[model samples]
Target: MTTSPPASATPALPEPTPTQSEQYSLTHGKLTVGDYLPKASHDGKPGAGKCEWSSHVSVALTSDEIGALAWVLIDSVMKARFGPAVQLYDVWREHTLDGTTIPEPDRQTIGSFVKPVFGLPGADKKKSKDHLHGHIGEWLWHLLTKDNPTVRAQPAPKGDVTDSGGDGYTIYETANSELRFRLWESKKNTGKGSLSTSLNQAYGQLGEHGQTYVAKIVGAYAQASGEGAAELNSFITEIPRAWTQGDVIVGAGVTLATHRPLPNKPFKKMAGKLPLLDKPGQLRGLATSIECYEELADTVRRYAWTAL
Candidate 1:
């Protein structure tokens, strides 16, 4: 067998020359959206004020682009659950300080949607209000404006820090556990629900065996029948993090309407969506292959896996 080249000077990812479509990854704070909802937030229930917390995602794409992504989000939602939820979010981004609305002519590109989760061994175990819908807005603002880098937690605790504060949701993570499109931590209640407890509580609702793909596209809240993914015994699995290394990411699913489903494509398209786990000899090298990363993403998109 041919020996791999000496480990040195891996080629760097090419910097794409500036294009109108590529405007510095569109920092949320700089964009009209940030003026509306600057950071990931727990704005709590929906309201009549400029912002609404109904199930949704805050996308950074133009109107047309939103439509394409919406289509895909809807597709993934359908495949994940029996069908789409009662309402979908499109149009009506929060109003900016200057009192202008960020046009979401196609509002479906922020990311996937998730259902409101409830019913675990020790959770309240009661139905919540319609106000509890879920969300999945882009972490654009934080990565663009905030001095601190965006964060993500890994396996056992597996989630990307797609947190753009002021928007109302963040994802917490774990190994073999499905990532949570989380709510901003609340200092209001303390007991089983300080920040850490509340997160763990929400995670358990998805159930250990669920492969449901239905999640709110922008913010959390969609209580329906379903199961939770897995749970890691340790509170500290892979802690929250950011991408220190570079990797490529490609859209796995399709986009549609002003809103669509999220990624859940075949295995070979979404692997590097997050950091890879370096399992011994076999699982190590494959991490570098985009196809493998894509496959890994596809494999886990359904639901977090549980130990047998």
Candidate 2:
């Protein structure tokens, strides 16, 4: 593991102007895309309208990359549902009778939990929207943290429950040496108005209810058993020393322009029309436009059933 730098260390800032955009291949080649026009510096101590802000644009994902990413995402869903140590037999046994009887409603849901990526999931009993949000939340988590080992899945609550402020949460030690906690919320929409509504709600959670949510996730992981548990406990236990007051950050993943093709309007133009939760310094944003959303669902379902 790369040792985190001292909290006082000056963290490397994003390029004010990325010449050709930054390309990355993640999830073992499951995702390959570029981040363009990144704005790292914030004006006036990190609030809106204080700095020269530019929203970054993501290069459209290829079919293969999207397929691969779906696999990784579905794998995460399985892990979140069944724990990271889950196996092929475990999935097979739980969803099947004997060894060949597939459950009804749709075999694809079960297959979605373990299959390989071909396309995204289709509707099943009116739960497709919720399912899509869950997968996208996990996918966003992996994208932001690069699948940090310490990141744990927040199991889906049993029964018809709600009020979970965010879709997912995790804590990591920043290279700047501060232990930073991030709360993730993903919103999927096809149009700008609906997407903005969702994005605003997510931002609202991060702004108004962020601290309490952070405490809840910290408390849960602190008591849980895992390789990350000890470190997580230590970080939460010593919150005073781990971070200066008001140093935490919030992030949101918004799916925009989904109704249209890939490479939608530049991030700046879209972002200009949207509300800012706070200063760019305290918030991070991942704005994406998923072109083949239905295919993404199918791909996730495919990976869930196909991969061990």
Candidate 3:
């Protein structure tokens, strides 16, 4: 009879390959994208009626995987930046392109370099709450678009600070490849009141300032270059007319911090809120609920510094 190998001599199990859902464009080399948020479920039959919306459960990330997802989200926005951050990002990108894992020391160095820009591990309570709410809302919207093959979204805001314009912008390509633009507003419910309070606020804000918001996004694209920039700019010029013709889509998403059961049709009641967007293919909504929301914010902050 043969004896078993000693612990040190036993072969180690190989790491499991990540599934398609767990992978992202930035998750190359040894970087693994974590399953932080659950697979989103359509609130109802999307596209069967007027508005489209989806729902998500509480985030499921421990300290183990939070950092990986945090890094991926940050990297996505970093694509639209310049200077030192881009330099650091390029270093990481080189490793991805080379199909090699970043060394532990380099990982720590890069993490430390970018941590302050993101306002991670924020000390001020109010600032931290606002930061988490705004960033997470924008991020969720960005992720939602990723699930739909026909939609291409602009990058989320790069940092913890919220901008004065719309929370997101997306281009939805129809079956024949005609592009339709969507302006999105995202909010978080931190008060003791209902999620509708936050969503209603988003609705009103979009109704009042939506045009100005769209203008800002279009202006930002004016500085863009590269192959498709001109084609994209042409589409941008049509947004005003599109808005008048009811071809543009307006969307609002809210993140609720509670354990209570959510409404089966959360956005149906708001059908009349934005009349222009009430019709088929014109309005979109998303509702994400999380337990211990503040705790998750703190955890995201802490794990962002994990490599350091």
Candidate number of the best lDDT: 3
Model 3 steric clash pairs: none
lDDT, candidates in the order shown: 0.23, 0.43, 0.57
Candidate 3 accuracy as lDDT: 0.57
Off by over 4 Å in 1: 1-29, 32-192, 212-308
The residue-level lDDT of candidate 2 at 113 comes to 43
Error of 3 at 111 (Å): 10
State the lDDT at 41 in candidate 1: 29
| Overall local distance difference test of candidate 1 | 0.23
The better-scoring model by TM-score among 1 and 3 is: 3
Tens-digit lDDT track of model 3 for 176-283 = 777778777777775577877777777787778887887787777644478656666677788865665555444433333333346777776555676766555667
Clashes of each: 78, 25, 0
Ranking by TM-score: 3, 2, 1
TM-score of each: 0.18, 0.54, 0.68
Better of 2 and 3 by lDDT: 3
Expressed as tens digits, the lDDT of each residue in 227-259 for candidate 1 is 332232221122222111111110011101112
